[model samples]
Target: MCNSNSLSPVWRELKRLQSTDELFEILSPQSFKWNIGKGTQILFWYDIWVGVSKLRDQFPALFRLSGKKNEHIADMVIFSENGLMWWDIGILFPLNEYEDLQYQMLMSLLRNFKVDLYKEDEVQWTHSLEKVSSVAEGVRVMVKSHIDFEFDRVKVVWNKLVPSKISTFHWLAIQGGIPVKEVLSYRNCLNNSSDDKCAWCLDHIESIDHILLHYSWSHKVWTGLFKWWNIFWVVPSNVLEFSVDWSNGMGIKAEKVWKLIGSATFWAIWLARNEVIFNGSYTCWAVIVSRIKLKVFQWLVNAKVCESFQLYVWSDHPWLLLQSPSFDMF
Candidate 1:
């Protein structure tokens, strides 16, 4: 076991891998580098200390002739009596013309490089602003590299106005992974076809679209929101289409509030559905509309969108509240 007490924060994190029973896999080397300090802990040839690549890869022929192949960076430096630093890379054999040229190029590259003898070597994650290695940063780097397409729908799904749970629900809903009755039936969780009826209406199959959008109960919820915004909108076939169309129709001034309201509307309807199914609560669209308004008003106040926002004004005439001078900053 490595002594964690002696290691830097980054190395200490890396050391935890040794305790795992599974075969250790190396992460992408290009995403990491050593921030050379004293350089005592970093391998001169093998580690990415000097540049974007390791010295061994950059000068393979010179590395083959090096006597101290496994030497640390500290071992390659020689200090004169006056404290001038000089590189004394131990070359095992005489250099040909091409090898001598490589040697001169290597020396030139190291001429301006300075190492602090007092400071300890540190590992840096190239992708993060802090240059510190972390699981989250590593995952982000890896995911970003692999993703080739533009995922603009994620911007619509993950709204900063709502909690992560709400955003997560939206994400799942977009992917058709939400446990609506139809999905449950498909997964063999619901044995009876009768159990797949819409929880709100019980007239149509409880699909993601029906329960959340097209059904009379949920449709009224959307209609109430549109009436509040005073905009004519044709509800799309599905959640993703609805989000795209709604977003496209928003004006610059009302865009932020509109997005927040849209997210709140979906969440409110879902909550109402759960309550009706699980708690045997009342299935009134009017009550759910009131809840959506209250939810959005509270979110605006909590987010400090406007200090003087009145709920009564928002409930009666949300358009006027949005048009108020207080919201001009938005």
Candidate 2:
């Protein structure tokens, strides 16, 4: 009898401050005196206030029509509609993005027909409790898994649960409406797009392959490394082939050369495209080759490296193979 049970779990202690009955006004409506404690909860008591009859209808699951019936009702908190259970805080919150997630999850749980799965005529409330607990745990897991990839891409992305870390090249590829595989395919199918001439030949218009490896400029850029490292390679023409065989079948020096060459070629091509578009200037082959040479030389200096790598470099970019004429020992 919540009517007489004005022992509001929230605000009953303050009423004890005064002992006199005159301090409060008791307006009896069928049952339970009201207008107590400065008219607090009077409106709530007037509106949604139910005295057994309405409570039975509104929340039949909690209260059966006939107390002796011992049968479940429509508002049974024990019923699991999908995994959506009575314990879900999702039930009590406003519908927002996160709430939408809850809603969808609940709908999915309902769609699973999990409520009917249990043969027990006696309702089980475990689904509600378990679903809520599971969802809460998943949310925490996902949030903990989120990361900002500014520091170390490989370490950050491949830590444990997260692994799909992207790079600048990936970004550019996205901008071009292409994927990594497509870019590799373009590498292999570097056929002349213009006339009968080969783009790489500089004697003819270019294709993707010409731009990557076969062009006269690219050939020169790679020649130095090839001669130095003695890498024997069969050029590929698609993303899949290149990704698989780009650095395979090569000695340590040859592998290093392939890595450097691939990087230089991709970098040079991207730069050349930008130069052509933004500066309206055609990059000379000699300039491209020289840039590759200078970059390899500088890298060798900085790395103090004299070992093999997994990526590719051109043979002509033999800055690594050549002994440093002078080493500044500090």
Candidate 3:
């Protein structure tokens, strides 16, 4: 009960309460501050070293740590008129490195200003924001934390874009069952000089577009499907052009079909290419069409995939539905 002890009894209460939980009052949405500007009110969870001069001259009760070879046990060292003083700051935390460290550095930048569709946030929204770049990065990080996602499909593309190699999308694609090999090969498709030809159609080297869009076989599959659906058949020549030129001119049905067309078609063609190379076999165009139809229908059926099947629909043709990964789409 003597007032001789350095902390005015109240600080001791705070230190003791920390044994139970964090020093701040735990409110639902945010932490609460009970006092400020007063001698007792403090948001800091740890001690603030008042420096040697202030401690020795102002408060005779507080003790100092030995500053031997900078190996002092105190949490922090302070310089004052008397020279130096060491005081315990708080509990030391663990460490973070690399991308985690970069992320933290990036998050710190959010303090500047971030604009979403129509919203704004300040830098100190959370100290944790210090661990990310923009608010968008923060959101993506939170999403990664809450949900399990991988980026196997786009791994190659993303890795090429990411220096120091921290790939969020690559992980997501992997989790989505996207073939990493394809992602790696997708780059080859982007470069025209590469001999990477369509594995399904040996007549042309496989590039991403060649496999997905312009291959002789892929063209036939899509073209035939479009004709069946009574829609215009306008296939872009390469991935870049396709991205720029894709249209839903065939109406609502075409839009739905287009969504699934690329994925389903590519999946089908890739599977066939494997069959030819590994199995040493090839199917006629008519057989290929039937197989594709069967595959799409199975996917549709199994997905119980009703109204939104259009998300998978392309070219407005039931024929487009046939070209899926496996015959399981029914």
Q: Which regions in candidate 1 have their CA more than 4 angstroms from the true location?
A: 1-148, 249-253
Instruction: Give lDDT per model, in order.
Output: 0.72, 0.37, 0.38
Worst-scoring 10-residue span by lDDT in model 2: 155-164
Best by TM-score: 1
Tens digit of per-residue lDDT, candidate 2, span 1-330: 122233433223322211212222211122232222222222221122323123323433322112221112222235456656441211333455754664455445434222233332221112123422233432343346452213222221121211123224422332232322223323344242122233224353343445545555556655644555555565555322333344442555344434444445456665665565468777776677667655554555455543334113322545434433332220
- Per-candidate TM-scores read 0.53, 0.32, 0.33
- For residues 1-330, what per-residue lDDT tens digits would candidate 3 score against the true structure? 101133335433432332122222221112111111212212111112222122222221111111221121122334358654333322134334543463344235323322222332111212134532243543454465553323223422232212222234223322322332334433233332222334565455344555556767767877766665666757755443343233333453344334343444445666676677679877665566556555545545555643344534532445444454432333
lDDT of 1: 0.72
The TM-score, computed over Cα atoms with residue i paired to residue i, of candidate 1 is 0.53
RMSD of each: 21.2, 26.1, 22.1
lDDT: which candidate is best? 1
lDDT of 1 by residue, 229-298 (tens): 7777788887877776666545535766777777777788888889989999966888888888887788
Off by over 4 Å in 3: 1-203, 240-254, 303-330
Once superposed on the true structure, which residue ranges of model 2 sit more than 4 Å away at CA? 1-167, 170-210, 213-232, 252-257, 306-330
